[model samples]
Target: MSILSLQGVVAGYGSAPILNGLDLALDEGDIGVIVGPNGAGKSTTLKAVFGLLAVSDGCILLRGEDIANRPTESHAGRGLAFVPQEHNVFRTLSVQENLDMGAYVRRGERAALLDRVFEIFPPLKAKRAQPAGELSGGQRQMVAVGRALMSDPSVLLLDEPTAGLSPLYMSELFDRVVAVNRTGVTVALVEQNARQALGIATRGFVLAGGRMRFTGTGAELLADPDVARSFLGG
Candidate 1:
């Protein structure tokens, strides 16, 4: 069964819907990438699923249970985690403290999870005591992702993870994303770097005008002449 599925999801800031009858699905352990032009509802999809926006219509299912219109906190408690594109971390908090905050909803010890987060992002281990704002853009992004991972989520939603990083850092971040997914967490990412994101994705989705234009394996989308010409910049 799919870990998360969106059926006819219609959502937006107010009443003007951004996601027009959007449908998406992801199985456990799959790295799914959503790529499209600006205003195509790539980030909107994640926001809707994360409950950052109200769903005006349709349902969002987590393991087949309807979670549409549920609060964001409730979704987190249900093993769903989201790392948004910006302002994702507490700038003044220490790296370790930021991670600790991510586990606020959990009821048990989180030492092991903390250790694992540091393991996944080794740079964080060395700067655990430093404020998140003192870190470079890439390291801060790592902190944001590590913070979300502290919750030990079953599904992770990332929006524009590599938005403003240098090429080297962008590549490194993608490697870390792959590393995170290797631990059996399903990842659904909305990325601006289409080709690079799709290269690492198990599945790729192309959205246009808030609707799915193409869906296939990453390799298939990369190799298709039409997809390449239109969305992949030829």
Candidate 2:
């Protein structure tokens, strides 16, 4: 089952378009990774789905409901969570506090949600009272992802979850993403690290110039000559 779908979605900044007729989908329990060059609108696709930009024309369906142009809360209420690459956590707040914020939409069930987040990110449980900003880069990323998981979202959208971290950290972060998927949350990853991203993705969509150049299983994309040469750094 597809948890999220974007059909002919068009969105951009003022007076300029970034995602042009972008089409994609994320099936339940599938880790879908989107990759391309710097200007390929990878982040924009996530932003559009999160309702951060104006989607001029197209339909964004969340579990078969039209979510295009819906306010952020509407998306959040339906168990859709977004964890952007930067500033994903509340720096001034402790790990527990940040996790608390992710469940703002879910009233009267806070205890269970907090416990669930800690289960997914064990480091967060140990440093529950420590400020999020003081953590190492990799740990902070864990907190960011943990916060998103607190919301009980079935679909999690991540933008460059391993942008600046070292190779070891990057590997660890992707490991967590796989763990999250194992627990049944569909993941949509927007990443610039094409080779690494495709390696773990069940389905890969290679975007170029705001359009999808290739959409196939991860192994298929890895084996394709054009995808390897153009985006996979062959």
Best by TM-score: 1
Off by over 4 Å in 2: none
List pairs with backbone clashes in candidate 1.
none
Which residue runs does candidate 1 get wrong by more than 4 Å? none
Question: Which 10 consecutive residues of model 2 have the lowest summed lDDT?
Answer: 101-110
Cα error of candidate 1 at position 52, Å: 0.9
lDDT of each: 0.93, 0.89
lDDT of 2 by residue, 85-170 (tens): 88788899998888888878775778987877777788889999999999989999998898788778889999999989999999
Tens-digit lDDT string for candidate 1 (1-234): 999999999999886999999999999999999999999999999999988899999999999999988888898789999999999999999998999998887648589888889888999999999999999999999999999998989999999999899999999999999999998899999998999999999999999999999999999999999999999999
> Candidate 2 local accuracy as lDDT?
0.89
Steric overlap count per candidate: 0, 0
Error of 2 at 107 (Å): 3.9
- The alpha-carbon RMSD values of the candidates against the true structure, listed in the order shown, are 0.8, 1.2
